[model samples]
Target: MYFIGELKGSSPDLKISLYKWNSKFFVKFETPDLEQVYKISEMDVSEDEIREMVNEEFIEKIITRFKEMYQDLGELMGDY
Candidate 1:
């Protein structure tokens, strides 16, 4: 995987990174213990376009999903 760069302006608790691998671009968002990766075809979207695509609104949705995922994990762990 090739590291492109880190995205800015989202929640500080979340770390966002861009990468290229296997002819696909990987958009990775991470918290302390959890992460989410989104894949995009290089043929479909250029690198510059990716910056535009992963805007505030997109980050907001990811943040929301992360919250839901964390909640689900907590429930499954059962008082741990």
Candidate 2:
């Protein structure tokens, strides 16, 4: 994978990286203890569109999902 660049809207605590490998584009979002990744076909969307897609609302949703993931993991670990 080739490292492209990070999202401008990403916060210091949350790093978002963009990568391109073969015919697919990979977007990776990482927090201190958790991460989320998504793949997109290069033919499906342009690089510029990816930037547009990751707006404030999108970032909010990602944050919400990260919270949910942390909660779920905590609960799972508690059970263990």
Candidate 3:
């Protein structure tokens, strides 16, 4: 089975999609021009629990990674 939903209260510039299938959860974070996906197990945890905890945690991580990536890109361009 498959299920999908949007993360409520997320930033307009950062849209988050949540999906569940095959006893696993898949989360996608997207902006106008960029996207990232994260997969995690559903083992032992209820879907509600995942929604409450994992979703926000993953989004925070994705945002942090994007920030770091952009910072590094700027530094690399500065070397030129």
Give the top-scoring candidate (TM-score).
2
lDDT of 1 by residue, 1-80 (tens): 99999977446799999999999999999999899999999999999999899989998899899999999999999967
lDDT to native, each model: 0.92, 0.90, 0.75
Sort by TM-score, best first: what order? 2, 1, 3
* Model 2 clashing residue pairs (backbone): none
lDDT by residue for model 3 over 1-80, one digit each (tens)? Answer: 36578876468888877888887888777876667777788886666875676556667788898788778878988999
Give the per-residue lDDT digits (tens) of candidate 2, residues 32-78.
99999989999999888887888889888999999999999999999
Error of 3 at 77 (Å): 7.5
Least accurate stretch of 10 residues (summed lDDT) in model 1?
A: 7-16
**Which one wins by TM-score: 2 or 3?**
2
Please report the TM-score between candidate 2 and the true structure.
0.94
lDDT of 2 at 30: 96
- Look at candidate 2 and tell me the lDDT of residue 54: 82
Q: What is the lDDT of candidate 2?
A: 0.90
User: Each model's TM-score?
Assistant: 0.92, 0.94, 0.65
